[model samples]
Target: MSLRVEGLCVARGEAVVVRGVSFSVPLGEVTVLLGPNGAGKTSLLEALSGILPIQAGRLELCGREMSRASRVVRARAGLSHVQQGRVVFPTLSVEENLRVGARDGLEEAFRLFPELEKRRHTPAGQLSGGEQQMVVLARAILSRPQVLLVDEMSLGLAPLVVKRLLPVLKGLAEGGVGVLLVEQFARLALSLGHQALVMNQGRLVYSGPASALLRQPELLQWAYLGRSA
Candidate 1:
């Protein structure tokens, strides 16, 4: 049930962005990817989601190879990705946008973010940033993914809101949903992660217990503050 990546290399045109990265995400655990900006965290996630082709690499999502597969195949196999920018359709009602994400029905999504039930008829564009985030997260969960890739889960939110989301993520992890939480907040990211990896220049520089990351002030300052994380 884990997402295993081996010798992953991603590129755009002639420029290599992620170079030979490798890691394993055990089932139900929260494995976080941390790095400064331009560390290729998002790019790596995109490749796993099958939204971007892996120029060179091997990815097994819940035991199925995804590098050469379609995005739909990846979706059906419990690999869900919630991108940084909310991608809800503006023209669609909140419920409609959610319905699009639901593989089975809307109830799964509603259960995750009950507020959406109240805003079911409203257009997604009218919602606040926090609300929009809920929509994206709930929608991803609607598919009943075993593995979830969350990009910047704390971005553009108040500290209180971020605090609230952390518990939900922890609950998910406890329930056996493997999560790859890509974030810029070093302190917060390490706290939620059972394990963490730091990436730089398209390569992984560190892979160990998340607790180890909290102890290194120099690494934390360099990883987050160095490049606008």
Candidate 2:
């Protein structure tokens, strides 16, 4: 496993948003996390990335324990997180954004996102939503993380643009990077995933093969509705 999270718990002030969640992201595979809004998916990713402290859990990356590691420490340990909202340096050019973390890997990033290569010199703020997302993803890839946690990569983008981005994640998984993806579009995400984990009311309602969950709409509906399956 590239990333192992066991009995994870996260609290927001007095409220506990994530409760006893556990799952693993294996190398060369995509683990799709599905749920409705306010399901603690973002909080879980934040905890794993060390942006938010975990209340209780065991986090292991590439066989090393990093439960209490700082965000920079986690990043250096081959963990990268592409957060929601397409965060980027608005004034920076696409190529400049890719160069923020590491000087190398520019070629690889451009290769992975050829559309970016065309606008490498353009400021990120001037690009479209999908292009900005591509820039964020490209920056994360430049870090060469062993495990990548992406939250809502398709947010606010058209279905056509989302279709273009989803395959890139699958390709990364095939290249031996463990990818944990939290997506709103369940069906599209499941099609490219090997494992599936469904969340509801801050807890996991289902965990199994992606294909298994894909074939059973009732189970997913139950999970989304916060009903046990």
TM per candidate: 0.90, 0.98
Per-residue lDDT of model 1, residues 1-229, tens digit only: 6899999998877889899999999877889898878989998999888877898879998778878988888888888999998778887898888778774668766677777788989999999787788888878877788899999977888877777677677778898999999976667878888988888888888788888777765665565554322
Model 1: per-residue Cα lDDT at residue 174: 91
Count steric clashes of candidate 2: 0
Structure candidate 2, residue pairs in collision: none
- Deviation (Å) of 4 in candidate 2: 0.8
Q: Over the stretch 85-153, how does candidate 2's per-residue lDDT look in tens digits?
A: 999899999989889968998989889889999999999999999999999998998899899999999
The weakest ten consecutive residues by lDDT in model 2 span 220-229
Candidate 1 Cα outliers beyond 4 Å, as residue runs: 103-108, 221-229
